[model samples]
Target: MDFSENFLHYVWRFRSFDSAELKTAASENLKIIHQGFLNANAGPDFSNAKIQLDGTIWVGNVEIHIKSSDWLKHHHQIDDAYNSVVLHVVYENDVPIKRKDGTTLPVLELKNRISTELITRYERLFLTLTDFPCINQIREVDQLVVDAVLSRTLVERFEQKTGAVIEMLNNLNGNWDETFYRFLARNFGFKVNAFPFEAFAKAVPQQIYAKHKDNPLLIEALVFGASGFLNDEFTEAYPKQLKAEFQFLQKKYNIKPIDATMWKFMRMRPQNFPTLRLAQFAALIIKANHLFSKIMAITDVSKLRMLFEGLPVNDYWKTHYHFKKQAAAVSIQFGKTSINNVLLNTVALFLFAYGKHTATQSYINSAIKLLETLPAEQNAIIERFTGAGVKIDNAFGSQGVLQLKKQYCDEKKCLSCGVGVKILRSSSNHH
Candidate 1:
């Protein structure tokens, strides 16, 4: 009675409870020929079931509840949806259920039929307080099972991440280049400023970038100016020039700037400051015109990495983290890790998404291979999975683990996971 209805559903689906002498509450012999498909919607628990009640065959829906009295409690007897229910399955037969026409409905009680050991296994996995429901016993699961789950989760992660890409593509009227530009700009914000960066990209059209692609200063002016950073008065000559150039471009192109307050500076590395990132982004745009086309042509992972290397930004950015806020001159190279993060989050995602859209296997393979070639990402989620003895060698493994952790482990979908299924099925005694 303390257990969930899902446990009863699982027991019935697997026939884990005693079925040797199944009988209806009215003393008629009952035999389950087919235990209908489990329904997830707002209807019967199972549909299209087949049963033989006292040598008479019946085919219809089957409903499950914790108690027979719940039939009246939930008002299912009066609901037209329950009219087709051929059988009622409950954990406890507290009272007899009647159909709308007032005939007593056949009931199958599972309280006494299910084994205690199966209950213990379910409780161990679903009721525990561990970080992951099966963390304590995950290592004991077979290697093949673990690998299968990870592989499944990897593709699931790809599909899940690319869903947004596909939606954006639809909005862009199937323009792969423009969609790629917007998504890449969003990733350039990394995490903190992704939204504003995306908004900034959307505010200015790609044609304007193409018009001024040859002029790096104009590009930087457009980037910083449109980002609302050029509005402030600057002591430095470069920002002053950027402000003047942006004013010219803003009026000529009818471009609007996002609010400067949208950018965050507190508790962030100066190297990752939005100003530097904007400068790097402008350099990237100038360096790679028709970048999506170039990316599609490159099959090698290193060649893809070369595309983001050595972006040429103005020397002012090398000493300044903000407008007129000059720090000790630092080499303002976009670090390898940052480049790889772009490749992983942006390049690989586009490859996978474009492949899915165009029905090209090569692009899909390239996307997956890129992840496999990249070094493993360092994060708390990866650390926890590695701590649990999960063998993650590269970004592919780490990403898969991240998806598995968030989707299955965090949601406590133990009964639905392959690893959790294996663990629960290991119980030797079944009714």
Candidate 2:
């Protein structure tokens, strides 16, 4: 049928073949005492399987393939690792296989043992022309199972996403506040200019900002100058003053600006321009100097949201999206949606990462609770899952679904996925 080797592994691992009259190719009576643990690494498909053959018990690894000839195709004949395999299971018994010791290995062919209906169901579900493999039947799965899967996926998502933050923590020599500052700086870019913003923050270290924290004007000058925004001549009074101030500060700090070409603005909304974001970011620095400590102390989500809301952006940014470039006056307030995004991405992630680093469960619990309190995010992936009857009403559910779509569905690792496993098992004879 040209199915993948993973499908055969799934069938063998789950014991989906008929076992009423099991026998080896040598016609010896066989019984399975225990189906070994599935191995994700090299050397074996399953390990330490216990089986009875010809009334004698044997304990060793088990290897499975689509055809018996695959043992030769994989060159297992010469590899000493395959010598411990007590049973050679295959979908079809096309040829006999010899162990590395030159002894004939016991073969268990399952050509007619697996049901045709089960194969067809797997083919239809996994081989479908859709991003979500089981979308059509997702609604039929039990709600409790869906919730359980989502909860697990949510933890997986947190683990996957927080890895970069922890690596940054290590690179900063375990400076939590400085690490948080850089992470917050990256998220301030909001994905469009995240790289340049992070580079800009690295170029102008937080210690430099701490020196001039009381002076909001110098902080703005350093942020803009280090971002390469103060390089051009400005005719406007405010930008001219900022340029003059940055020229002195840039020499004092010995800071070099990142490439101006790093920032992007095409097809972007004016409010999301990097210049406005930089001004708001400088305002945030002026407002909160040591932000990581404040975040750790606050458990209430509302207070956390308050940290990003109503930032004191200056009048120049309130009327302009760029330095010396004036646009129609717009409210330069960071919108509610943007505030929530910051809370979710930066605040919750740092809390979770810090909790894991210090072995503190309260911080982890607070992180999850904050996500549950926030509203669910709307995106292309969330929409598809919601359309498939999956209930995702909070950031917790949305994050889990996002992880599921990216890790499981896109990769087509159905055998390892909770929802895919449930559907496959229900469709088969396995319990």
Candidate 3:
């Protein structure tokens, strides 16, 4: 099977070829002293490579390709960047190559040099349809390799999450409190109504809520009205009162509510309904005057839990799911799972983003510690990794596994992954 240039880079970077039998296409004995650093940007594939050809030691950039003719095909001959390329590596020596100065360039063919076992392992990984490309081989890989990769991937996942937070920060003009409020609003909606909740938060700016934050009733009215929940007539006294309050605030602030149809409730638990989430959000807003500051000051998880739990939903919501719909008097208190979800998605990410913005190591460390302290997330992706013999002890590992699966494994980027590299390097010995 024909492989990509990336595969060649992987082989060359790892020295996966038979070094003892190395020879150029023109019959010159060759030895690689150093493979050099792989270049991420344009120019050469590798730079500062040291290769001993015959008796002369050449030091310069190294370029690799599937075919020797790719040198001209890529128009590198006319480009001055290829002038320093001391060694040309190819899988197929299709044609002789000459530099811009009319001198024949030495070519090293890897077709016969690369181990068959390595090719097989690479093919197996790239061609597989499994949930994870390395699922079958993951069990055979060393635990140390898995640990190191997971550790790296955990940081990668945090950085990925940090990107979203950074963008939000940028949009909010570096307003940490506003950004955190928007993020919390989205998480409150969870997966089902996240978009609408986000829209509601954006529509009713944090400044508006800060004005009347002392009054929980007014806050709920604004939130519920801006969510389009108070648009319809209600038989319940609480709904009518909220509607009245919201109508007054809506005109004062010139605020617009999001489309009610955008909020989804099908197949979701009644406790997770959009109305209930909005009510809970208003309660949290009322209790935590400076929400972000209050969160940053506390390190205890129980205190954080209490901060979320102590703020009970309005009495109307305690026995109702929607405006007029009355359910059994089951308490609508924030459950442990919902609280943890906020901690994981909102609080932890807020800490990380704030730490990054302030360049404070302690907050960053706190963010990581918070993730480690939290329980692992329950989802299909984590379950698949567990089934594949990978141990996930906390949110850190689970988050890393999630990043690994989504970014690297799903994209078939095995060469860039530590676990994939380990598996490829060990395959030769196994065969």
Q: Which numbered prediction scores highest in lDDT against the true structure?
A: 2
> What is the C-alpha lDDT profile of model 3 across 1-431, one tens digit per residue?
65789999998998888777688889998989999999999999999999999989999999999999999899999999999998999999999999889988999998887888889889888888775998898999877889789989987788788899999889989888888889999999898888999999998988888899778889989888999988898887888999999999999999999899999989878878887888888888888866998989987644666788867578888788887787887657778889988988888888877888789987788888888888999999999889989988888788889889889988889899998898888865532
Give the per-residue Cα lDDT of candidate 3 at 218: 95
Q: Looking at candidate 2, what is the lDDT of residue 265?
A: 94
Q: Point out where model 1 deviates above 4 Å.
A: 232-237, 358-362, 428-431
For residues 1-431, what per-residue lDDT tens digits would candidate 2 score against the true structure?
Answer: 86888888888888877888799999999999988989999987999999999999999999989899999999999898999999988889999888877899999988888888888888988889788999998898897899899899899999887888889888999999999999999999998999999999999889888898899998998988899988888899877888899999888879999988999999999989998899889989988888899999997866898888778888887778887667898778888888888889999998999998899999999999999988999989999999999999899999889988988999988888888888877877652
TM-scores of the candidates are: 0.89, 0.94, 0.93
Can you write out model 1's per-residue Cα lDDT over 1-431, one digit (the tens) per residue?
A: 35788878877887778898889899899999999999989988999999999999999999999999999999998899998999999999999889998888999988888878888888888888775888778888887788788878988999998899989888999888999999899999999989989999998867788998889999999999999998888887888898989999999999989998999888998888888899999899899877898999998877999999999878887788889787888768889999989999999999999898889989999999999999889999888777777778888888888888899999887776788778867773455
Q: Which 10 successive residues of model 3 have the least lDDT summed?
A: 298-307
- Candidate 3 residue runs with Cα over 4 Å from true position: 300-302, 429-431
TM-score of 3: 0.93
TM-score of 1: 0.89
Give the per-residue Cα lDDT of candidate 1 at 320: 84
